[model samples]
Target: MGKSSTSVLVILAFFAIYVIWGSTYLLNKVAVQELEPFMLASCRFTTAGILIFILAKIMGIPLSITKKQLWNTIIAGILFLSFGNGVVVWALKYVDSGFAALEISAQPLIILLLMRVLQGKKIQPMSVIGVILGIVGIYLLVSQKQIIAKEESITGMVMIFFCMLSWAYGSLFVAKADLPNNYFVNTGYQMFTAGITLALMSLAFGETWSAPLSWSGGVQLSMVLLIVFGSILAFTSFNYLLKAVSPEKVATSTYVNPIVALLLGWYFLDEQITAQSIIAATILLTGVYFINTKKTLAIFERFKR
Candidate 1:
């Protein structure tokens, strides 16, 4: 691909990740009302995993890997897909889509702290301030009675918090861990492993499989959306961006997702955007800027040497 073409693809990929993946939050919220949440996620991922595996096979992309690489990918899949994404899917059953988006926006803040603690990365002064500001924003956003007062919703929030932490750690791990370079292979294994784990969990949890399909059209549509938009398109673009952009730049999508999700929620569901949400979004985006943009510019300046 030419440089311009690559740039355009990157931009498109970012948009897919930002907009499509963001919309999944609300979709999940609506879908869960008609389906078992974990089962819903398992079905989505299983289908996506199968499609990716098929694509990889048809393209003759090497899917075989060393034992070490297999183990690493499996671990990442468990942490990211099963725990991280699974939690969010389950939470949608109890939380509003817009509120869920706000809570999930905390991932970048979690990533900053995890990098400093786990990877021995320096916590820049501005980044520290950003984390603090982001947390305050999340607090304000989630303090609404609609979000916090419901016991099931509160449990969902806690699960989502852990989900963010797991996902943050998984991202850093992917950066540092030895793995295959082919995005298809890496993503294929991750989805397959995650899908299997989630499916098993869903079965163990006694999620009934006897439910009629037509009665759950919304859930079926949500699953299709997740597989096509969320898993296949968004994920592939994101992994491609990882190679083309700085890790920090790729991380910016985390912040961008909530903005997209909030907007989509308002448009489709007529969800109100409150002053608290706007304020929280500003703080969160500002924090993401500090964590990603400042560091990226600093690194580029050093590269000019």
Candidate 2:
């Protein structure tokens, strides 16, 4: 592919993770309300995995992968999907989707710290400032009296934190790992294996499985969107971005995701948007901006002399 084509794809992939993934917070919340968390995740991913494979085959893309690549894909699947996203969906049972998205806005901060510790990368002066702000933002966001009052919400928030850790590690892993060259195949293998893993988890937990046809209309619709957009498009874009841009820059999706999720949750789901949430979101996003501004790719850099 030409530099121009790659640049265009990069832009589109970023958009997928930013805008499309933002809406998934609400979509997952909707499905989790009526369906078992792991089961819902399992069905969604398995269906998406099958669809992705089918689409790839139809496009004459090769599905062959080396054993090492397959293993890496499974590991990636477990980290990114089975535990990272599936567990987050489960946590949505206790926390409002918008609130969860806001808390997760600290991801870029986590990724930066991981890079510092794991890769011995030096944090720039501005990044230190961003770190301080991110810490403050997180403290403010989680310290709300109303939020702290609910034990369920507290548990959900804690689980989400660990889920973030899993995703952060997965992001770092993907950047360096050798995997299938095709983004679609990479994502398909990950989703398929992760879906199987989630299915096992659901059965172990004694969660009853229900057919998609039996789910409520809203849940059914949400599952369709989740499978098609969230699992396929957004996730493929995520893998593509991991390879195209730096991990910290990819994590900037959190900045826009929370805003999209917050509005959708408020408008469609009647979720509360507290003053504290607004303030925390501002601080968190500001911190993310400071951390990423220097690293962000110029859209027209390829064309520049």
Candidate 3:
């Protein structure tokens, strides 16, 4: 591919990561209305995993890995998919998709704190302020009268908080862990491992699969979208972006996704976007931008002065 072609494809990949991923939150809400959370997640991942595995094989990518690496990938999958995604799926029963996305937007903040605590990394003062602002944003979001009107909403918000923490830890671990060099192969294993674990959880929890048989066309379509667009396409695009762009650039998805989700939720699901939500989203995304680009932002400020 020529340089211009490559650049266009990179932009498309970024679009997939930002828009498709944001849309998944609302799709999950639609899917879980009829399907059990664990079972729904299991089916989505298993299908996507198998499809990606086949694609990897077709591309002649090696699937071999050490037992230790396999274990590490499995653990990472549990953290990311089972706890991170599965909990959010369950919480969708009580929370709006937009609210869930907003809550998840705080992942960078949590990851920074986790790194500081676990890796003993020192945080700059601006990053510290960013984290504090993120916390305040979350507080403003969940403290709204609409959110606190229901007990289950509070539970859902709390669940999303834990989901962010799990996802952050999984991301940090996977960054340093031994895994397949091929992104498709590595993600295949991770999704497969997570699928199997969620399947077991579905069985243990006595979740019925027959519910999906009675689902509406909209719900069924949402599941297909979640599997194909949300999981497969978006994930592959993300992996591609990690190779093509700087990590900070890829991290902008965290800022863009919540806005996309909020708009979609309001348009399709008629989910309310209150003043508090807008304010919280502004605060949260601004903090995220600062956290991700603190040095650049500081330099820009210097130039302005």
Candidate 4:
């Protein structure tokens, strides 16, 4: 593809990650109203996985990964999807989707800390400052009077924190681990493994699928949207962007998603957007910007010197 064509595709991919993934938080909130969290996740991933697998096969993508790669992919899948995503789905029962998005926005900071601790990666001073600011933002968000007024909201926030941690670890692990060169094949296997695991978890938790059959149109539509837009399109776009653009540029989705989620939640679900939320979001996103954009900032500082 020409440079211009690639640029357009990159921009489209950014839209998928920023808007579509952001929308999934609310869609998941709607889905869990009728479908249990694990069950809902299972269905969404299974459907998306199957479709992606078929597409990969048709595209002649190599699927012959080693046994170690398979096992690593499965482990990453469980961490990223079954735990990271499934837990968030369950927590959305108690937390507003907007708040869940805000909490998840701390993921880049968490990933930096994990890399520093687990891999002995040296964090820049500015990044450390960013991490500190992010923590304070989280505290402010969770300690809001409205959030503290409800015990369930506190519990939900705690669960979302764990969810973010799992996602960060999974991201780091997948990046380091050996996997197939083909992004579509890798994603297909991961989603398939996660889907099967979530299905078993749903059965273990005694969740039934009957509720979805009788769900309202809105809830049913949300499920379809989650499977199509959230899983298939957005995930494929993200995988493409990983190759097409700088990781730092792709990481900007973490900053954009929460804002989109918050606005959608307010408009569609009537989720409250208090002054506290605005202040907290500002602080949190500022920290994220610093952390992700550290490389560019360093270059600018050097030029000044």
Candidate 5:
């Protein structure tokens, strides 16, 4: 693809990822009302993974991966999808999707700090300040008495925190590891490996797939959405963007995702967004700016070699 076409693809992928993944938060909240968390998630992703793997192979994207690469992908899948997504899915039972997305929006800060510690990458001072600001903002937004009820909300927050941590660590590992050269192949490996891991865990827990036919309607709809848009479309678009844009540029999607999720939550579920949420959103975005772009831009000259 030409540069202009590639740029457009990246932009399209970025927006699609932002909207679709953000929309998932509310869907998650609704789904958990009718289905068990891990089991539902396991079913969604396993089906999606299988579909994507088959499609990619049919499209002539190679599925061959070395043993070491397979192991690395397995580890990444566990940390990123199994634990990270699993936590988010579980959190929906205790917390509203809007609330969960707000907490999850703090992921960029976590990722930056993880990069610093694990890779010896030094963040700009402004980025550090941004992280503090984001944390304070998130605190203010979620500190409401009703929202922070002792057992429920607190547990949800804990889940979100670990989810963020696991995701960040896994992303860092993917960045450093040697994997398949083909992005499509790598994506297939990721989804299949991650989905299988979760599926096995679901079986170990003896999760029954015996929902009534009445609720099967919603289950089928969720399954379609998860497979077509969430798993195949979003993952492929993301991988394409990874090739098209710089990593730092692609990371901007993190900032965009929460806003989309907030809007979707409000529109669909009638979720109320108070002044505190507005302030928290601002702080969180500002922190992302510091952690991701502001410092990098300021220090660009030094690293331009």
Candidate 6:
């Protein structure tokens, strides 16, 4: 019974990260239509972070951390949430959610290259092939004339590329950083600080803010789901699955999320799934698989959408 129950929980956790995290792309797309991008991220992270902390306290988990840890969490928060997520939300104003998800699916490739450059890690032969395929896939996707013709689309693509860089570097940082020992506490601090940073970024950009009550029903629902499901439930499940399953199994989300986002965007928003995009997604995801086949970048897996 004990083993069966544990297996059930593990399966459910995988569902949460796969479906819920995948759906966040659509949720952010919906919310960004009505809210300032940074502000949308701010509200989601702030509310979720606070709830995590409150839950931690209720469960008698320690919240204390060293000064160095606090500072590291702040940096991680800014990299992973304030810029990585917030900037991607901003890009959704000009880019299709599914398209953005596809491009970001190159994240593991980016992390692998970064490891080569920053850490002097040798690319395993398989990862080297993954890198070549990933590059070709990205070129095929981004070189679409229709997408590049729009100036704003081009700009959104560029910014999202930078956001991927931030996320990749954050993963490398977190792997070695002195963070809170408990994953939940580390995430709480990161989210809370990133929330505050995003709010400031919103204000600095002179973006207008509105009360939740005044938001459109769809946007409001999107925000609620993003906060409670995308930010909280799915994230907690990710942590749980990291303990309960192999890192390679948990890493499957990296490939699955973009596919989910693509399907949802097509079904709900009538977003076109171009033939070229299909080719690109297939190639890109194949590359991600080869990269993760034998190697584990568990920290990199943990941080992305």
Among all candidates shown, the one with the greatest TM-score? 2
Candidate 6, 221: how far from true, in Å?
A: 1.0
Off by over 4 Å in 4: 1-9, 211-213, 241-251, 294-305
Q: Write the per-residue lDDT of candidate 6 for residues 114-231, one digit (tens) a residue.
A: 8779877677777788889989999999999899899999999999999989977876676667778777888788889999999999999999999999999999999999988998
Candidate 6 lands at a TM-score of 0.89
Candidate 2 vs candidate 3: the lDDT winner is 2
Q: Is candidate 3 or candidate 5 better by lDDT?
A: 3
**Stretches of model 5 off by over 4 angstroms after superposition:** 211-214, 240-249, 294-305
Highest lDDT model number = 2
How do all models score by TM-score? 0.90, 0.96, 0.89, 0.90, 0.89, 0.89
Candidate 3 lDDT: 0.82
Query: How many residue pairs in model 2 have overlapping backbones?
Result: 0
Over all chains combined, what TM-score does candidate 3 have? 0.89
Residue pairs with colliding backbones in model 4 are none
lDDT of 2 by residue, 1-305 (tens): 99999999999999999999999999999999999999999999999999999999999999999999999999999999999999999999999999899888888888878877987777777788888998898898899999899999999999999998999999989888999999999999999999999999999999998877788889889999999999999999999998887787888898899999999999999999989889989998888767766443342122111
Which residue runs of candidate 2 sit more than 4 Å off their true CA positions? 295-305
Mind giving the per-residue lDDT tens digits that candidate 5 earns over 1-305?
A: 69898678777888777888777787777777788777777767777677767877789877788999989877877887788887688888887778788887777678667767866778778777877987898798779777876688899988889998997777656655767777667766777777777777777878765453556576667667766787777766765654454344455566667787788779987888888888888888887666556557546324322
Question: What TM-score, to 2 decimals, does candidate 2 have?
Answer: 0.96
Candidate 3, residue 121: how far the Cα is off, in Å: 0.9
Question: Which candidate, 1 or 6, would have the higher lDDT against the true structure?
Answer: 6
Local accuracy of candidate 4 as per-residue lDDT tens digits, 171-198? 6666556776777777777788999999
Question: How good is model 4 by TM-score?
Answer: 0.90
Model 6: how far residue 181 lies from native, Å: 1.8
Error of 3 at 49 (Å): 0.6
lDDT of 2: 0.90
Q: Write the per-residue lDDT of candidate 3 for residues 111-227, one digit (tens) a residue.
A: 777767986766667778788998999899889997899999999988988988888787667656677777777778888899999999999999988655688999889988988
Off by over 4 Å in 1: 1-5, 210-212, 295-305
